[model samples]
Structure formats: structure tokens, C-alpha cells
Target: MSTILFHEIVYGPVHSRRLGISLGINLLPYDGKLCSFDCIYCECGFNKDFRTNTHLPERENIKAALEDKLQSLRKENAKLDVITFAGNGEPTLHPKFAEIIEDTLFLRNLYYPTVKISVLSNGMHLTKTKVFDALKKVDEPILKLDSAFDATVRIIDRPNSPQYSVSKQVELYKKFNGNFILQTMFLRGEFEGNKIDNTTEKEVSAWLELVREMNPREVMIYTIDRQTPTKQLKKVPLEDLKKIAERVKQLGIKTNVAG
Candidate 1:
């Protein structure tokens, strides 16, 4: 059981390889994971195994905890870059997601006006108007789009709903009006009896074509950096990641690769 659950509502002004000096907001419960996508490469293990709290954290409580952190950071004059909504699961799944984003932006102005507010989401909740509206407000609305092929998406992401389709996801991305950052997690592994790998030529080709369609602000490409729930999963090599990045660049899309 390789678990990396965030056990606090307000955690780390930790250094991020891609986003600098981020203070993470874990909207999910302290002990459990609740995400729409059960990614084989998720840092936090699978859903049922690690979940502890059924009730989502209260809006007031999250604000209080965040304010406390922001105030402390302000007192120290800390170099904060972004306030990211990413934790045990999909932050947008929180019922009061839009309200929280509103609170976060207000707080951002009061404490660190220049710092960006970001949300790390699986894009499953985009159909919901409120969730989509809130996501558009963030500086970095980072949405996951690991693969363009529906079958590969089903295998790699294991979306909770059987109805999950890549074409629909691309449409949701279109709603953003080329204003969002697209993130992809490239990996190779086996789940149950099936062989899983998204770094292949076929996978990348499909993905590249779709990335071109989205015409996002930028494309983030990365490999597994921590132990995944699935022990058999393997990280896509940096060289191979860069190769994919080069192809993405050829599409005239800026690509960011992280190990």
C-alpha cells in the first residue's frame, strides 16, 4: 500500500518542481482520498483504501486554516508563488468549490495580491456550471488529460464513470477558450491482467493531435515522481518525456516537463 495522503486541510508552502513555492489546499478530508479519477500513478493511493473522512471540510474551516497560513507567511514575508487546490482528491468535487475559490481570491488580494491561485482538477466536474465557472477564475486551471484515446484514458485514469470520454473532455477544454493549462501523466505499467502504457508512439500521437485541438496556454508533461498505488507501474524516462515534448512543441504548444 503506497499511500501519500495529505492529512491536513492546510499544508506545505513546499517547493514544487513546476509551480514555485506553493501552499497546498487539500479540500478533501484529512485521512481519505475522494477523486473522480483513480489514477494508477496518483501519489495518494486508491480511493476506498485510504479514505477516512466522509464529510467534506467546511467552507469556513478551510478559509480559517488558509487565512492562518497566509497570515503566518505574511508575517515572515515568505516568498509565496501560488495557492494550489490539490490534495487527497479532486478539489472541485467539494460541494462549495466555487464559494471557496471566491474566498481564496479575496484572501489572495489581502495577503499576497501578486500570487496566483491554481486548482488541480481531474476535469470530471466541468459539466457542472458552478465548478466550471470557478475553475475559469483561477490563474492556473490545471486540468488532467493523460491520453486522447478513450481506451487509454479508461485504463490509465480509471474514471469513476463508464461514461467518461476523451472527446467530451476536449469539448470541456474548449469551453475554457484556450485559457487553461493541460497536464498529462505519462507512464507504463500493468493493472490486473492488462498492460498499461501511455508513452507509446500510438498514445503520444493521439495525445499530440488532441493537444493541438485544445490549443491550451501550455502543456505539462511529467512522469511518476513518487511511489504509485500500483507497484508494477513504471515511470516514463526523462529522455522519452522530452521526445514527446519536442513533438508537442512542433504543434506550436509550449510544453513543460517535470520528473
Candidate 2:
């Protein structure tokens, strides 16, 4: 398996393809990953490794461990650009997600005061009041929106709820408005026997429509940069990514490419 699994609350200082040198906080289990969306391109594998009965670390424990780690790193004058909430599954799924975010804020202020806190969420829980509120507290809440079409989203993200529709997701994004950074993983390939492509002219047009409606602070355009769990997926080239970013920019939306 991959060493992305951290035994405790804190891990990394690892190079984040998008966020630079990041210190990760995995609120999920150390032994496995847990996320609301079973994305075909998930780099940490899948949720089969997750044991639901296993308990997540308590808030006090998280605070203590994170403070200890950050304090130690501060003493060493370590370089860290972001404290990211990322792991095997979804970090927002933790029961004390709000408390943990608060604690992380407290620690981030004390030690790396300039370092931003980011959450790489699937946006499945954005409908929940608590989840949405907790996400609001983070510095950069980068939510995933792989597609605007219901069928395409289902094929790509494989969201658990049958009722989780693109319309509902768009409704949720309306609430975030400028507070959120919309991230779409632009790529094309085959999964199972179905042909998949989210970077085509049709797909890009739909995405740009949403970007214009949401008016997000920025749009992060990128393709697969690692070995994904699925074998048939193909990466979108850098030129293609830049082209998509340029289209998004034409709509007056700021764009960043991590291809």
C-alpha cells in the first residue's frame, strides 16, 4: 500500500502537486481511507480499507498531537506552505470536523501564522449545515466538481446517494459563491466499458457555464499526476489543461493549472 497513511493525526511536509509543501492532517483512520465519493481516480485506493467500527482520534487528542507536531516543526523553523485536510478518505467526514478545524486554526495562528489551511473535500457533505459551516472556517475550501451533468458525475465520482444530483450540487455552490475555489480534474479515458471524457468541447462548455454562474474566486484545472486506482484512465496533457484554463479565463474566472 501507499505510505500516505499516517498513524497519527499529522503527516507530511510532503510535496502537494497543487498546494506546495503541505503538512497533512488525516482525521480518518490511520490504517485506511474513508471518503464519501469513490472517485475512479482516487490515489489512495478505495474505501474497502476503511473499517467503520474504528474510532477517529478525539478532539483533545487531535489538538494535542497537532500542537505538538507544529510546535516541534516551528522550533526547527520548518517550511510549510499549507496545512491540508486530506487523507485516505474525506477529512470532513470526521465527527469532530468543526472542532478539529477550530483547533487547527488555533495552532496555525500560534506557529505558522502565515500558512493557509485548506480542505480537499468531495463536496458531498456541503449540503449539511454543520459540514458547510465547518468548511467556511477554512482558509481555502477547494471543493470538487468533476462534471455538471448528472450521468457524467455518477460515472466519475460514483457518489453514494442516488439523490445527489448535479442540480443539488449547483444549488450548494451558489451558497459558497466566492468563498470556494472550484476544482475540476479534466481528463478523458475509459472505465469498465464506458468511454469517459470531461475535457471535451461539450464538457468544457458545460463547466464554463457553471464557472460563470458560481463566479468562484479561482478555478484549479489539472489532470492525473499520479498512478490512479483505475487502469484505463488517461491523463489530460499540459497543453490541453492550459487550453481549458484559457477558456475559463475568457469567462472572467481566475484559473490555475497544476498539470
Candidate 3:
């Protein structure tokens, strides 16, 4: 039942496995989770378990808080590799997500001109014009696509939308024109009474076909790195992750594996 939640609007310059030294921005409520997907493996636990009563952070408050943190960091001359949009839940769910990205870009340029801005999204809000364009503005729009099949996605990501499909996600990713980073969480285990594994030959081959079609700038393949809500889940080993990355590499796509 253990979980992790960010209780601040602007927090962390934590070492991230993928993004390096990162400053996190939590646009969701500080007290609970508000995500578009209720993934079984989510570290924040289930959305129903952490029902939020607090409002999403205001754009103005986010701007002010972020600017203040950047200003302080600048004064201290801290090494920040990236400003990441990730928190208890989906960042693009914020009403003024686009404006907040604009604000973040301005502040980033003002404070850490070279530091990159990255958004770790579930790819649920890409259909929203503002969210799509806002994601395009960042240096890295790391979008998730855990499975090539809708059924597997339903079991893994448990997206709130019944309309979510791998084909639709691929179409949206195609719009990026190979500019986005595709992130997939590879894991094996059972959820509820069903056996789940995205690493099997069938799953990986189908996923690879989509990956080839999207032709994203890079693919990040990794496994569970922390305690997940579902106790049945198990991490994919580094050697196995490397093997997957090799498959991606063979397709002439840049890949990164984090075990």
C-alpha cells in the first residue's frame, strides 16, 4: 500500500534515471492524484485511493513558484539538467497547460537557458490541440505507449478513455514527425486474476511494428523502478531491457534502457 506523491507545486532537483538532474513541476493537486489513467503499476497508487479535494495549481501560482525556485537555483549555481513536468498525476490535465508551458519556457530561458524542458505524459491529452502544441514546444515530450494492443493497455495503463487505442496513439505520434520521445514501461506479472506481460515475443513484435511506424526520435525502454500499487508485478531485468533496446537499435531508432 506504500506510495509516493509530490506535495508541492515546485519540488525536486532529484536524479532521474532518464532525464538526469531534474526539477519537477506538479500541476496536479498537491494533496492527491488526478490522472487520466489509473495504471495498476502507478507509484501514486489508484486514483480512487487518493481522491483529490484540492484544486489544480493555478497558472499564475505555478509561474511564480517556478520562477522563485529558478531564481534561487540560479543564485546558488546549481546544476539542473532538465525541468520536468511530472507529479502525482497527468500534467496535461491542467486547464491552462499550454499557458503554463509558455510560462515555464520563459522562465527557463531567463534562468537556465541551456536546461531542457521535458513533459512525462501518459499521451492521453494529445487529442487536445493546446496539449499537443504545448508538448511540441518542450525539448522532450516523453509519451507513454505501454502496449500495442488495446486490451493489454486496458490491463496495464487502464486509461480512463474508452476511445484510447494503439492505432490512434500511433496516428497522434505520427503528427510529431519523429520529434517526440516514445516511452514504454516493460513489465511482467499478473494484475487482479489476469496474467500480464508486455515482454513476450508477440507483445514486443507488435510494439516494434508500431515503433517502426511512428519512427520517434528516440525510444526509452525501462521497467518498474519503485514500489508499484500492484504487488504481483515484477521488473524486467537489465539484460532483457538491453535486448529490447537492441531490437529498437536494429530498426535504426535510437534507444535508451533504464533498468
lDDT of 1 by residue, 1-259 (tens): 6788888999999998789999999998887889999988888988878867468899999999999999999999899999999999899989999999999999999999999998988999999999999999999999999988888888888899988999999999999999999999988879987898888788888888888888998999998888888889988889999999999899888989997
lDDT of 1: 0.91
Candidate 3 — which pairs collide? none
lDDT of each: 0.91, 0.85, 0.94
How close is every model to the real structure, measured as TM-score? 0.98, 0.95, 0.99
Question: Model 2, poorest ten-residue lDDT window?
Answer: 1-10
* Model 2: how far residue 214 lies from native, Å: 0.7
Candidate number achieving the greatest lDDT relative to the actual structure: 3
Q: Which of candidates 1 and 2 reaches a greater lDDT?
A: 1
lDDT per residue as tens, model 3, 182-205: 999999999989999999999999
Backbone collision count in every prediction? Answer: 1, 1, 0
Candidate 3 Cα lDDT to native: 0.94
Better of 1 and 3 by lDDT: 3
Model 3 segments beyond 4 Å from truth? Answer: none
In candidate 2 the C-alpha lDDT for residue 23 amounts to: 92
Local accuracy of candidate 2 as per-residue lDDT tens digits, 129-234? 8889988888899988998898998888898888899878878878986788999997789988889999878888987898888888899988888787778888
- Give the number of colliding residue pairs in candidate 1: 1
